[model samples]
Target: MREAAEPRRVARVILLDPEDRILLLHGHEPDDPTTTWWFTPGGGLEGEESREEAALRELAEETGITEVELGPVLWRRYCSFPFAGRRWDQDEWYYLARTTQTATAPAGLTELEQRSVAGLRWWTSAELSAARETVYPDRLAELLQRLLDEGPPSVPLVLAPEIV
Candidate 1:
């Protein structure tokens, strides 16, 4: 058995536009650009900031979308993966947010993000389902469609570990 790494607490936003398309960031591992995936906009909490605060801050910094209506935590996940030469164990909270901003101009990005992030795009559930590329939190298309059909769940859904 392998040793368990300390979990890094992270807050991620599932940003949706009025058109219902979800925003996602396309990025790759810094150490291996060939390995890529599309993921939500969010990052780890800074200082004593709450997950909600971190979600908003990260969203603005990554996508320049600050004017948003932050919704509830829709999902939670414990994922472990390797990137940029280090292994990450992340306990993440996925919050739902709506924004009118369609275009993105990054306000701020850390060195790591600057290197890892490739682009940002809005994805319809159909596009996600048809995509040949990878998307984090597997089954995201199905999950998203579920959320669209039925509003946010009364309780946050606990997702299975994504170990890779």
Candidate 2:
């Protein structure tokens, strides 16, 4: 049996607008521009930062919006994927946050993000469901719809794992 790679803990935010659209960042591999995908704002936790702290810090750094309120963890997932030049095993937590601000001026992107990230866009559930473009963690539309309709679970839900 193959041993699993150690997973890196990452904190992500499900940033919602007043219209309920979720914000996603578009990016592509540096070695393969044709390989593109959309994902939420997030990064690996540094040092001993709590999940909430990492989420908030990532949100502000990636989106340049600091006025939002961080809410509870809505979902968690274990995902393994190839990015940049390496495979990553990521244990990611999704936190809910709402913001009235629309403009994003990402000032703190890492060098990798600066090169790979194209831009950010707000997506509606319907748009996400119908999109032909790739989005990570598979069924993002369904997840967003469930969250919208049912609200956050009393306890954090473990989302289905993804390997891609």
Candidate 3:
């Protein structure tokens, strides 16, 4: 049996616009375009940065929206998956954020992201709930509706771990 690899810590932003729509990036594996999904804007931390800082930085880098109101983490997730032909185990913190900017002007995207990302879109809760394409952190629509209706949880909710 193969030993488990150390999990990568990632900070993700659930960025919502003034219209109550969430922004998601469409992306595929670097080597496999057919394997695709839509996900929140975020990335792994850099050089001892706090998750909040990483979350904000990633939001700026990935979405090109800098004016943001970062909120407390709404969820924590653990997932093991394959990307770029390699298995990745990630321990992720998902923060709730709001922005008025609707346009995207990505500032700095890693080579991997440049190749993987196809586009960005804002989706309403209803649209997300009915989406046919894959989205990470399963039950995103349900979770998001909860956030909209009740606001951020006082403590971060621990999501069920996933392996894909």
Candidate 4:
């Protein structure tokens, strides 16, 4: 069971490759709540901006991944909870970003400066799978496997997470 959403905003990306890596950022968990061991590079969507634009802006600002093809909405979760006695609502949206060049981002980003994320490394699917306990785990991995068996397709993915 899940609780109702709180009042907050957030946007994110799921940059992937034919090989198993997806762009990710490492960060220290909040001390008080102890949440967020690590998180992808993203921020809140400004008013009147569409989700796609917000996502693109966030990736560019955080990971220097501007000018890439942003795909359809791949995953969306409206979650809220209390941690360290503070209520928070996180409406996160994930997208598939395809690019020919690698990405660049700041390093040594701290929780403050909020934009302090400075990670510029590629993480393999195996790494993501291994960190499922902390980071997001979605069917995109299975989709990657499928694409491996059959070369990348020219279709849009209306995906929902796989459950066992």
TM-score winner between candidates 2 and 3 = 3
Candidate 2 local lDDT, 24-108, one digit each (tens) = 9999997777878999999899999998999989988999988897899998999988888899899999999999998999999
lDDT: worst 10-residue window of model 2: 29-38
Top candidate when judged by lDDT against the true structure: 1
Q: 2 or 4, which is superior by lDDT?
A: 2
**26-71: candidate 1 lDDT, tens digit per residue:** 9998767788899999999899999999999999999999889999
RMSD of each: 1.8, 1.6, 1.4, 5.4
Ten residues in sequence with the least summed lDDT for candidate 1: 28-37
Q: Could you give me the TM-score of model 3 versus the true structure? A: 0.95
Once fitted onto the true fold, the runs of candidate 3 whose alpha carbons sit more than 4 angstroms away are 1-5
Model 2's alpha-carbon lDDT is 0.91
**Candidate lDDT values, in order:** 0.94, 0.91, 0.93, 0.59
**What is the lDDT for 126 in model 2?**
95
What is candidate 3's lDDT per residue for 52-152, written digit by digit as tens?
A: 99999998888889999999999999999888878988999999999898999986899899999998999999999999999988999999999999999
- List ranges where model 1 is wrong by over 4 Å: 1-5
